[model samples]
Target: MTQRVVVDPVTRIEGHLRIEAETSPGGEITGAWSSGTMVRGIELILQGRDPRDAWAFAQRICGVCTLVHGIASVRAVEDALDYQIPPNAQLIRNLMIGAQYVHDHVMHFYHLHALDWVDVVSALKADPKATSALAQSISSYAKSSPGYFSDVQKKLKTFVDQGQLGIFANGYWGSPLYKLPPEANLMAVAHYLEALTWQREVVQLHAIFGGKNPHPNFVVGGAPAPISLDADTLAATSVNVQGLEIVKNVIARMQAFVNEVYLPDTLAIASFYKDWFRRGEGVGNFMTFGDFPEDGTGDPSKWLIPAGVILNRDLTTIHPVDLNDPMQVQEFVAHSYYGYSTGKDTGLHPYDGQTNLDYTGPKPPFEQLDVAKDYSWLKSPRWKGNVVEVGPLARVLMLNAKGFEPAVELTQKALRQLDLPLEAVYSTMGRTAARTLESKIVADQMSTWYDALIANIRKGELAVFNDAKWDPSTWPSVARGVGFMEAPRGALAHWIVIRDGKIDNYQAVVPSTWNAGPRDEAGKPGPYEAALMDRHTLADPKQPLEIQRTIHSFDPCIACAVHVVDPQGEELTQIQVR
Candidate 1:
């Protein structure tokens, strides 16, 4: 008999996911499906709206990566209009995007993903003295925030004492995957607390460049920050060296945790849960749209992180990407609930695309080719009929394939420094570590750009946005453009069709759409679905947190791709804690 185990309303990550793992009588998972059950009709809401205003609306898709989406949407519109902003605009965009990365990554690590690995129950067993010592190793700021750890401990105690885990109540603390002693857990718990403090610092980076966090005001041609060349303006524009230093320092603290704590902790857990590396290791295919402008060229190949597509299973090398080439990219809304004209459910350009929302359960084998029976909010995205993984794993995989010396060297060094074999760097742990390390790489490279801008300014190279003449009438009668931005999660692609100075159609095949997609035309499972199949389910379903951590490590932004719903959908009273 097939039995179903479900975890509805998976929290922490954005969106509500109802995951059902179907297992045989022997307890082996035979099939698993993740459904995003909430629909906000963001696309439908954008209809009849000015193309320029789409970015502002798109930014509301997810609170975490709001600015990234906003910028990407604006970039798509700009590309559609063939409009280019000035150098100062480019620099400001870079600054905003970079700040988002730092803020998003830091928050994701501690607030969203940490609870999966951290055993809050173990923190109760920790000796406060030892925990304090671990904090000192992080940095002076960590040491100074003594009460933060205490508060976290108090909070955990209250929850555990109250017999309600609240957010963590259902977690599997005794699972074999949790190998850290109480002391280590205490240290992580302390860092988790301190991380909340740093979140404020990182968010200031966002407000400095973009105006706000959830949705920043970013103009298409340039930033929305009012330009000023006066002394006071220069002082405000002055790169907050200390603020950046605090971020670098905080990340360094995180790195210490990785090297001294997380890496070792992961291996220890994996040693007991060795079965995971094989399971949930979906299509070794990885793709990255490299980011960070080099010499102010929008050419992706010139970006600090070079963009490339790779078939990880075969390790095929990808050539340079061309947004103008239609044959190179296509979206199949076969499984999605969209209303549109349909042929083979596959086509090129804004005209041939269909948006029909007729999900008739899972694909019946005969109807699979017809694209009518598939059920999913996610569109089938294939890089030449091959499922490709996108995120840090993909980033590192492509970097390794290209033989990028610095990236390769850094990977090896980071792996070695963690006392793990080079091969370990290829696993889930490495993915987590790669994201942290990428920040270091980005920070160093961004500094070069910063210095260049400064030198140029001293040499009378002006870096200020001037007025731009934008005549919407000059736009094509019918124009289509693709905007490609490398989000913290992975390559983010947006296709926009504009006609008569208004948005005709727009579609975003976000990172999660690739990672968390459903079945496609040929009956091939999506990258994440396939990855989860091979996973050896631990003894208790409560420990599903392990599975959650592994998946969330990629920082899947499902909220931006599909819809979701609270399975319980029950309203509870909110009581303020004074």
Candidate 2:
């Protein structure tokens, strides 16, 4: 006998994600379908707009990933125009991207993903003194004390007694799937609260560089903020002596927390959930578009993260990736709620990508998505007709394969501590752990990039914007380009064609679309579907904490992957949070 389980509007994620699974009588997930309920029309919105202004509109793809889209957008315009930004601009951009990586990974782990493993209700049963001892044993973080844990427990107990978990509501509080003991649970809950406060300090890096956040300023030629050394106008200038010092201090705080709290917590929690390190290994293939340029060259050789494709978990060879190659990266809409001019089965490269709405009725009460037809709003993106996973794990795997020192050292250390081999990093627990490891690495890089910026400033080199190609009259009659970065979630890119200084065609193939999209024309599942099918068993289909663990491991940012709108350019649904 087979059972169908559905989780609609999957909570704790950025956008509307629906998962339908078919389980065997033994409750092992036999099959799964990943669906992005929302429809993304940002690409459509960019049509006919100024090529230079695309970044402003594109960054609205997600409120959480505020700066990444702007980065990709500006890069696309720069690539098309063959524009060059200064060395200082590159370093500043790297700092901003690094800060985003650390901030995003921390937030995802604590506020979004950690609850899947740590039971808040269980923390109430913990002995505060025992929790303090457990915390101190694993990490040197100073917040752990009997009184501190007791106070956290008391606050949570009040929520439970008052019949309002508030932020902790709707969790499977007593689920058997959660492996953490009460004391460990209390330790994790304390850090979760701490992370919320930690995030506020890090985002100041964005404010310092971009002048604002959740939609920061950007320009096609270069960074919008000019570096002003005048101390008198420190308050008014985006990049000033005061701002740089604040940024330096913020990097220190980020590194301190990751070293003391996040890394230790991930390892300690993984010890209890060793079984997960062997399961939830998704599609074996992975890809990264390389980001964080050392100089302003935009060459793969200068990027901090190398670009390549790893096929079938093979560390033996790294395949070259070409964004401009028509046959390399293509989007399939056969199973998506979009259409191609040729046919649904036909794949179109981003340069020729289309966004035609082909919504089949999604009038709820779905026994299961019509697996035989279009089921997701996101288009399934394939590389050379093969499914590939992208994100922190993909980048880490690339680093491990290429023998990047820090990644290799961190992976080996984590593996040795857990008594698991290097191969274990391919599992769901590994995916979650990779985010934590990457956070530390990025936090460290933030300081290096900051020092470089300071060094350039000391040398009296203060160019953050390039006005060489700022005027549209200098652009060619026709131009096209692709801008890419390894976003916090995964690899993200924007392709644009400019005709007569206007956006002729625009398409963004985001990370979530690559992972959360539906099956391809060949009927092969994407990463999310494949991961859930990888030895995942639902202890209680009603709760489905098992499903949440695997899915959250990918850190779904559906709002960036898909959007919502009808053909009439009007709202189809008004989602009320209540």
Candidate 3:
């Protein structure tokens, strides 16, 4: 008999998800379906409000990267109003963004993604002394911890022995894909606890400027900091080098762990569970809306990582990210509930746009191409007419292809240090390492911009902000603009329309909208759907932790799109029990 196995309300990650895998009687996996069940209408909520407030309103979409939305929303409005922010304001934005990348990347690895892979149960067997020795042997940055990991281990041991998982209460631990030895698991577990502290310290970056994380309020005209300009307070205007230094040190430690600990751990785990690399591999197409600090200039291409597109299984580059190029971008909502003019192109400004909601059951993007059916509210997304991967994996692969010499050199060094083949740099392990590597690049670029800002300030050239005055009256009789920025997740796009000074319409295509999206009109499965098709299922369903680990690696953030909930609560609760 064919069986339908459901893993609903996946825990330990942001938002809600219910995955159903269909198995044939012969025990081979035949099909999979991804479902999202949440309802958030930020778009609908902002229907008649002042366009400026859209930034304030949209920023509430997600707590982790609230500032990103704030920036994107305001930028979208500013694009609508044709306003330009000042130089110092740009620097502040860059600094906050830099801090965000550091904070989000670290949190993703340690708190969110680590538990999925790191075995808490196995940690009880690790030797503190051996872990310390291992730490000191790999990188001196670990020395800064000074028994931090040991204390964390002791705390975890207490929690586990008490059978009070607490922070780990909802984690999937007994999954078969967890392949770490007891000692390694123990070491990773301690780091996981230590990371909670590390993550808070990183958040201080956002606190200093935007005031708070999880939706910082820095917006269009300028950040709210409004320097007093007093000589003494101007002195206070000095960049928080100490905070930046802490972040730098934390990143150094992270790189060390990636090189010394995590890389080796991944290889060891993958060796034991090689089936992962062979299966769950989806369409090899990848895309990156490139990001990095500006060299006191507006030339994005000169930024550390230039934006680009990649296609095909072997990964080839396509240059010059042209948002207006019709052949380069299109959206098909055939399977989505949203109403739009059929065969609409995302490039043709939002002013001349249409949105309609029509729903149809799971259907293939094309004829003779159904594996399973999508029950997701997400629309199947395609990039410039092809299926493409996004996130750290796509970013890393694109950077690797661009031959960004620094990233390339560092990646090679990372692979060699772990005694792993260079090919290993191409799998799930590669995704984790790429995030850390990108963190280093961003941190370094941030320091450079800091120095440039100081030079501009000393030269009395820092423009705090451009005038926010705009004749909402004379505004383009009919204007449409699209804003694109690299969010921590991947490329984030917002399409805006303005008529008679009120938002005629606004649409945001977020990162989750791409990664977790259902089938588009063409019937192509989104990236995550294709990736999960061939995963190995354990004999015990309760141990679906591997699924959790693999999916979390994408750092899926569904909040920006919609809320996913499970109505069949008892059925889900029972799966956890068995």
**Highest TM-score against the true fold, candidate:** 2
Ranking of all predicted structures according to lDDT, beginning with the best and ending with the worst: 2, 1, 3
User: After superposing candidate 3, which stretches have Cα over 4 Å from the reference?
Assistant: 24-28, 142-150, 170-176, 228-279, 293-297, 313-316, 340-374, 418-426, 468-471, 534-539, 564-578
Candidate 1 lDDT over 1-578, as tens digits, reads 76666666567787655455666676666766655554434565565667777887787778778787787788888778777776656766776676666567667776777777677898998766666665555434434244656676788798799997767776677666676667667767666666677666556555555656667677666666644334444323443334344334444544444444334333333433343333456567777777666544476666666777765444455756555566655666545555446453554443345454554454322221223354556676777667777876777667777777777887786556555665454445556666766655554455565556555555765544433525677778887777778788888876788888888887776888777776665767776666656554535654466457566766777788765433364533332212
- Tell me the spans in candidate 1 whose CA falls farther than 4 Å from its real position: 132-155, 162-165, 233-279, 313-316, 343-352, 359-373, 418-426, 460-469, 564-578
TM-score for candidate 3, please give it: 0.84
TM-score (C-alpha, index-matched) for candidate 1? 0.84
Global local distance difference test of model 3: 0.62
lDDT of 2: 0.90
Candidate 2 stretches with Cα past 4 Å from truth are: 566-578
Q: Scored by CA lDDT, what does every candidate get?
A: 0.63, 0.90, 0.62
**Tens digits of lDDT, candidate 3, 465-507:** 5555455665776665666677888877666776767777777
Instruction: List model 2 lDDT by residue over 258-307, tens digit each.
Output: 99999999999999999999889879999999988888887778787999
Candidate 3, run of 10 with poorest lDDT:
569-578
Model 1, position 138, has a per-residue lDDT of 41
